[model samples]
Target: MVFRSQRLSWPLRKGLSSVRVKARAKRRLFGRMLAMKPGMKGSLIVVVEDDDSIRSSIAEILEMEGYCVNAYPNGLAATEALKRTEEPCLILLDWMMPVMGGEAFLKARAELSESNQRVPVVVLSAVSERAQGQPGVKSCLGKPVDLNRLLETVEKLCLSGKCA
Candidate 1:
């Protein structure tokens, strides 16, 4: 009688027998799940930056990491869009822009309904310290932002479910 181990060919059995292959697959799956953390799926992140390159790059990076992004050229456009669309999970605001600067946007955002006013803002500016005590401002990152730190801050805030 043929033994069970002898039923399969060596090549087929060898492919399935490697512990490294199984471990690698498990790690890949876990890494993907970790990248898009729970409570962050489908979350929208608004980016308001005057520089075309900066806005596009920021949006691209966030999208790659699994968050939906809506980028605006100026604060005025962002404020107007905010009224029409669902509230975003977070706003990345640049300090200076041609149409409406960050300060003006913050003021306008304050005058909105209570729900809109609660949305968290992260100021990305040359002088980020100026925004420290501002109401609704959750965090500040200076110009030439560290992408890793930005991601970490976003993960912390969004994971807490407070930004939603």
Candidate 2:
């Protein structure tokens, strides 16, 4: 299961509690790097959604969690973004949107080279839609995503070189 239970250890929470403010400040700096993860290499997460509020909110959360998030108003925009950029480090796709939905974008992204297509995508869907094992994408995530779970999934995908 890519999305696991979010149960932080007491010790870890205590440590985080001590540096909450520092974490917040460091979050944006790291996010602004256009990647998240240790070393020069970092992970890129694309958040595709039509709703402005949802897209912005998720962007904030992902950034705070130390992720390079690129928010798109729709899948078409995301596709164009992909063309300009290197590849999808990770994709958080909203199911329903105008002008090329998430599934369409997924199909398009799947056709890319394995090296480029290997970017794992976690679909953010409201309905019970799903994307089976594609060249890159990880799995489906029901709407109202648990941020902690999303973070865990991102960490797992970034570190393990495989979607959970």
lDDT of all predictions: 0.78, 0.66
Using Cα atoms with residue i matched to residue i, what is each candidate's TM-score against the true structure? 0.76, 0.70
RMSD of 2: 6.7
Q: Which stretches of candidate 2 lie above 4 Å from their native place?
A: 1-42, 132-135, 162-164
Weakest ten-residue segment in model 2 by summed lDDT? 1-10
Predicted candidate 1 versus true structure: per-residue lDDT over 1-164, tens digit per residue: 21112111112234454455446545654576577655665588899999887888788657656678999999999999999998888899998789899999999998777787888899998889888888889999987777778889887776778544
The local lDDT score (0 to 100) that residue 34 gets in candidate 1 is 78
lDDT of 2: 0.66
Distance from true position, residue 57, model 1, in Å?
Answer: 0.3
Per-residue error for 69 in candidate 2, Å, reads: 1.6
| lDDT (tens digit, per residue) of candidate 2 on 51-128 | 787788777666666556788898878877787786646678887789888778878776666655667778777773
